[model samples]
Target chain A: MGLIAREIEAAGLPTVSMTSAWDITEAVAPPRAVYFHAPLGHQTGPAGEPDTQRDLVARALEAGVSIEQPGEIRALDLRFPDATGWEATAYTPEAIPMSPDGKPNRGAPREPRA
Target chain B: MARPADAVPYIERTRALYARQAPYRWVVHDLEHEPPPWTPIRSSLASSRVALISSGGVHREDQEPFHFRNDVSHREIPADTPASRLRVSHFGYDIRDAARDPGCVLPLRALRELVDRRVLGAIAGPALSFMGGIYSARLVRDDLAPRLRDLVLRQQADLAYLVPA
Candidate 1:
């Protein structure tokens, strides 16, 4: 996530990535980026949690607008009202293999379709 | 500016958790004491295609699941990764149905909607996905970046929306 942001930002496009994992976000630290305290797998807020989703998305869009220099990292101040802690929940990780047209042949090999 | 106390418990907890996990020490420590933001540039997506990547560690059946053996740490999947399908790999939210919808988690639908609304110039084909959980710092920096570079370039993606899972 961070690396892709770095490449995009390096390519001269301002980029901001929303990451739940501070380690990854801090390291990748694109020119403009934000970190969320949400768990991994749901950085854009709790999946279908509409209001939470709206707020996070807004923050991400805002980061792109507000950033002023290179390698900046901001923490988006949004959270799920019901989350007990970062450790209190579990989510199933799913695969999104690119369709025949979507695969990036030069990058990681497409995982075989199930 | 401030939010209600209940609205940010996760923020407070995440700070405490980061203290305990201390996972970000390396990156935080290495960054210039005060790095700044860069903006005001044109949307790179203006003339070129764009892509979106996620780290929720979501994947499909035939695709090998990210190494979940440790129960505590996992591998970093890069942006260009291709899964036969998608899933919701986290343990927090209960939006299972939305997870399957792909639009809910990956939001290609939202981007398309943005294009329809003219919020964006266009949609980039070849959205990307990553495993989202790896714990090792060396691998993420050294390993993942190169792969992401290749992915975006191949897609000819001028911009990318990286929504961490």
Candidate 2:
């Protein structure tokens, strides 16, 4: 999503990413972003909390325009409940063959030793 | 909203949302481009047109749902669409909060309020929503990103807020 933000900004538009994924936000480095320390699914604020959510959104919109630096991330202090309650929604990939040192081998097949 | 079934690995969970899933190791991309210079906000929010965008997998009830199967597609939601008529469908994170309050993920309601309160100039039309679990940069760069660019431009949207769920 930050990648897409970059593209949109590249198109001569100003973009601000109000995102919860700081690591990825830093990785993609959009023009302007406000790191909401909430949760993955909730970026504005806690669920069913409209006033707080609106406040956060208002702050973010202000940041979108007031921000001066490129790739700037203004970290907010809004903390959500612990994520320990959330379920793992990850999707795993296929396995790869490992080498003796426990490193996965990506090279071509080698001839058998005599 | 249903409770999360297990502890969420916030780190790995977000990483999987868009990172390439290499079988051996995590592959990170150095997306460091020459960051665009600081462009000042287009006057006041009450004057410049604002665009609302989200990565929360939101769409209109009548439109086709986000293609989580492909994961690279995006959807366009009309700005006038009410929050009650909107819905979310993404697998990256627990969608319970977003389901209960789409504003939690998209902030559409807040954006609309800004308009109503005269805090914003106007709400740009055809806001965007897309599945964010895309792992391929090529898909983002060459295809999906360009489509988003086109949307912003076509709408004549002066400022855009991208709320990534």
- Best candidate, DockQ: 2
The alpha-carbon deviation from the true structure for residue A51 of candidate 2, after best TM-score superposition, in angstroms, is 1.9
Q: Write the per-residue lDDT of candidate 2 for residues A1-114, one digit (tens) a residue.
A: 777777787777877778665666655577788876664677887878778877788877786677787777786655565565333332222111222222333541221111
TM per prediction: 0.61, 0.78
Model 2 ranges with Cα > 4 A deviation: A81-114, B1-33, B36-38
For every candidate, what is the interface RMSD in angstroms?
8.1, 10.8
Instruction: For residues B10-111, write the lDDT of model 2, one tens digit per residue.
Output: 456434433544522222435455554344566687787888778888877777766543477778887777877877776545565677678888777777
- Number of the top candidate by lDDT? 2
After aligning candidate 2 to the native by TM-score, how far in Å is the CA of B108 from where it should be? Answer: 1.4
Q: Which parts of model 1 are misplaced by more than 4 Å? A: A11-13, A21-28, A35-39, A49-59, A74-114, B1-25, B33-40, B44-48, B60-64, B69-85, B89-105
For model 1, how does the per-residue alpha-carbon lDDT over B14-125 read when each residue is reduced to its tens digit? 3443354544333442357644334346553334354666655555444445543112223333333332245544432333433544444565555654555555566555
Per-residue lDDT tens digits for candidate 1, residues A5-113, read 6655565545567755554455546666666665444556565554455445655665654666566566676654545553442221122222122332232223232
Candidate 1 chain B weakest ten by summed lDDT: B68-77
Clashing pairs in 2: B46-B121
